[model samples]
Target: MKEKIKKNKERGIITMEKQRLRKNKGITLIALVITIIVLLILAGVSIAMLTGNNGILSQAQNAKKRTDIASEKEAVSLAYTTAYAKNNGEGKVTYSQMQDALDDNGTNAEASGNIIVYFPDSERYYTVKDGVVEGPFEEKPETELSAVEMFENGQNCDKQDGTCTNETHLHIGDYVNYEEPTSGEPCVIGPSQTGVENYQVYSLENNDLNWRVLGIEEENGEKRLKLVADSPVKRTGVRETEEGETITEGVGPYFDIYGAEGYLYAPDAMDAISQIFKNDDAYEARSMNINDINQALGKTTDEQIKEKNFLTMQGFIQYKESYGPFEGQWTPEDWLKQNRPTSIVSGEVSAYAYLIDNGSLPSELSGIATTVENERLRSMLFDNVEPETGKAYWLASRGVYALSGDSYASFGSGVVTSEDGITVAGVGDYAFNSNGYEFGRSGYAAVRPVVILNSDVLIEKIEDQPDSWQ
Candidate 1:
């Protein structure tokens, strides 16, 4: 019985030991789970602090940017003050002075015109007006301004009344109403005259001239729009006699009057144009040259006649027979060869005739207009105008023409367009007919002014008109 009691005590001791071991294991498992949860929570918080819009790193970067901007602003301010003192306390500083002051501070800056200055360090732009600095903000790219854009933006009209269309598109040949300013210097015509002291001062202010778009052309590395008046503005001879008759007395032999140093783009005409634009330098006014007229007529220079066969013996014979009752003997072939096609517009055939034939003329000059388009172009350029009013309009160009059969040539002569045709005027032509020949037969012409708008000049509005050429 004592041996059984001892065995029971032993069994009880083993059960207690097993229970203690299980409790310790449970405690260890619980501690391990708590430690993992704590680590995960700390990791999430650390991630949140390091990233996103309001993170610690973002705040630090923003603060650094702000500091840099402040430093740049201080530098610009110091430069301005230095420049102001150097200018004897003047309210404004010149562009060079401002640049020099900025350079002295070891700060690099860029300028746009005489206005805005850009700082590269802070990527900020500032305006220096009257020697005062005004900005420390990020710079925005400037929008490119154009004539069509300005018109479509309704800059000149009251949009509330719907007098303007925001989608209006501008094109060549469209009419525009540009009023000459009323307060500028008066335009002086022929300020200095030879043999006589005669000049005219014209005030074109407040005049809304109906100008037609000739097209866009590039002048001096800038694009500009060209416009021509619909009619002659004034009637005057290129070189007028005392009695108001046109003459070419002192013009050098050959056509020297319409060249670079001649009547082409006359200085008097250009000076008058400049005076008209004294209040607004963006607009340039001048007399239309021959090439300008050719462009308006949808023709190009050096293309009016074929270069190879234009003044050939066969072509000359055909031209004379087609357009003349020839009484003068035809010149020798050697003479014809020596004085071949000499000018941009070559051939005995009229420009109108060449256009009608589509620049393809047969040896017999029997080519007919294949389409009515040529006739229309001819009428638009030369015909369909009042004979008296549209008689002679001067084109600032030199012209050369030689008759095949006679000692006839017109050189250094003013090119004029008239109801008769485009011919050399001011300098006379030496021509002989079946009856007789005439020499130095000069005529008078009026001025047709053209206006050129610089690329940067913004137009406020354009009048709506049907395209007549179409």
Candidate 2:
């Protein structure tokens, strides 16, 4: 019996040991499964972090690129406007001209930078690198007066025996010298009439005609005359009267008079006057008076025209007292009073201040950076970025006519948070683009900077806000 009891106990101990071993094995299997799952989760997270839209590396690259492009654009714009202002009305400077300037000055493209000026009339943009011109924007059509017309305009002339002849008829007061004469007297031709103040003379040498006045000389209280032609000149009639009277009838009777050689017709001045009146009236219409040209250029004086510049949002506000009225709204008698800087987003305090100071935001600000359809975004950006506080806000909703033409519309509400947890709201889209606005050619485009502010401060502002405001 004693032996049987000991054996039973040993059997119990063995069974217990086996049970313990089985439990350990089960625990090990469970731990292995959990470890596999945890590793899978970690792998998934790693992939998402590297490939997500907001991945750190990608965002950093985009930000860097944006900043670089903005800087480049700003440099280009400053150079162009400065160059234009310096060289206005000197005739359009082709790209090659700019390139030559840069090349002569030894400008460094990578460091000193370059500019490209665009002349729309020439349909070309001149590329200026390191202050040197590179390329013309595009070829332009050559438009010039024809040779015949130019010649007829008195570009051609010839002299024979102290007489000047041109394809176009001659008028009195026209000065002529014989090509053969080394230093002889100049022939002064008298008009058909004394009162004939102006006349058109055709150049027979170059087949051109020009207008001239009669050369009047008073010697001892007696008026003397000179003729473009010397001796008995034969006159041809290009145009005759109805009665077949030669238009040149009373023009001249060439002779050496008062020691001055040439033909003089003091008594027939009235005939010259009559012939001028008989000519077609088209010449009167084709002429451009000085007043017309001045009018076409808008204002002649620099003081009459308004000046503009691209400034930062803060800078615009600082100078708001000087801006003009809103575009298409009203003109100020004192332009300084009426002009004001405005943002796409209404109620942007900074923009209001800027408009009040600068008069107007750049026209390019409306659509140069982005399409005109996104004006609303621009407006929203302005409204959210508050001044002094330096915070930006964004809105959740969209509105109608959010963009006017190519300008962005200001709408919605949101705040931009700073890295240090400070929050200011009501910024606009064009705030950053405005900085870049003046840096490029007239039609050049730029990207706006995304608003950045303190995130912690943003959350706090939202939490502290009333439910109604939200």
Candidate 3:
């Protein structure tokens, strides 16, 4: 058994039993080490591949950028195509023209810039500049213009920019820009430079009245519009009765329905400008004057005048009510009541009554330049000149009457204007007849109308529209 164990002796002497040489196991160990080294190298290479600039995260980001840019470019191209198709036959879009359309619903801007941008909504936008379809802007501007804002952007236009113009040759009935609703009397609504089809015309009850621009005024740092009748209204009445009387039907201290305040109470101007209000049979007839429209300006009701937003009643009457040209004293209301039928002396003239001669509520009323005491009705004249012809028109001041000691308050009377530069009033004086009846009237004169406008309403002139000659 001992002889069985063999060992391979190298060059040494051989033993009885050769020891088998132990084959070196070092080779296998070496092979294992080599394999571990190779595995380590592979791990290092994998980490580098995941974290490099051209790795997965980077590729994903690039894909997103490409998608977004393509989407934007497509949208910008679409906008231009659509605009051009509807561009009213203009071959190419100019930067200014495009901007004008974007800035305003109406456009006429013509410039040389190549960029045209439109910000549709807070989050939607596009820019067209330098002939490049730059973006469908991911972010929008902070402030935006309103629907009406663009319409009101021009200053007093001395020249036509397709929006506002200086309007050097405004006719009597020419439409002017009124940045607010108007009050006072309305102009006759009809075919004109500003078409009735374009803007809504204000109406009283049912019928239309003439409403026109008078002038622009400043109030609380904002502009206000002044309006008046384009022409003298046709009506009739006399200047005096059988004898000279201060206490009269046609005059104020208004015991009769013909008083200034009474214009709305009843259709006192029946012969002058009274029409039927179908809804109310009891008050079937009403006066379609400035006072009536003024009273109905802001009511919650759904009447025609209220819907128009045409104007606002003027409330500033600073000057003391007095007679124009002549200096005298004639008290109103209580004092006149205390005095009785003969209380008003023949010589005493009221400045308030004299206001009838006012053609317009002036920066200081021009034309007859008379004064009025009516808190309701404002007298207006065409400044002695015809609205279209520049010819002088007539006006009214104090009405003449006769004191017949008629307790029925029935006396003959008529309105009259002071003889001077010009006068504005109803052509005929509204007076009482000999029968002591209110209609006991006579004579014919022109009716000049006046009105006031509310702030913030725009009255833009239409381009290419010509003035309607009177």
Off by over 4 Å in 2: 1-47, 50-53, 100-470
Compute the lDDT for candidate 2.
0.27
Residue 234 of candidate 1: its Cα lDDT?
38
lDDT value, candidate 1, whole model? 0.46
Q: Score every model by TM-score.
A: 0.46, 0.18, 0.28
For residues 1-470, write the lDDT of model 3, one tens digit per residue. 33444333322335322333232355666777887777777667666655668765666777876675566455555545555556654444434334444444432222122343444332434555433676555554332321122223422334322333443332223343422222223222212211112111222322233444433434444333444444434322122222743222222111123322122222233322322111111112222233322222222233432222211111211112222221132222212244523233232111111223343344544332334323222322223343223322222222223222322211112232333543432212333322223342112222333444333223444333231113
lDDT of 2 by residue, 237-289 (tens): 23244486535432221111110000112112212211221121101111111
Error of 3 at 264 (Å): 12
Better of 2 and 3 by TM-score: 3
lDDT of each: 0.46, 0.27, 0.32
Displacement of residue 121 (Cα, Å) in model 3 is: 21
Q: How many backbone clashes does candidate 2 have?
A: 92
In angstroms, the error of model 3 at 203 is: 8.9
Stretches of candidate 3 exceeding 4 Å from the true structure: 1-173, 176-210, 217-222, 232-451, 462-470
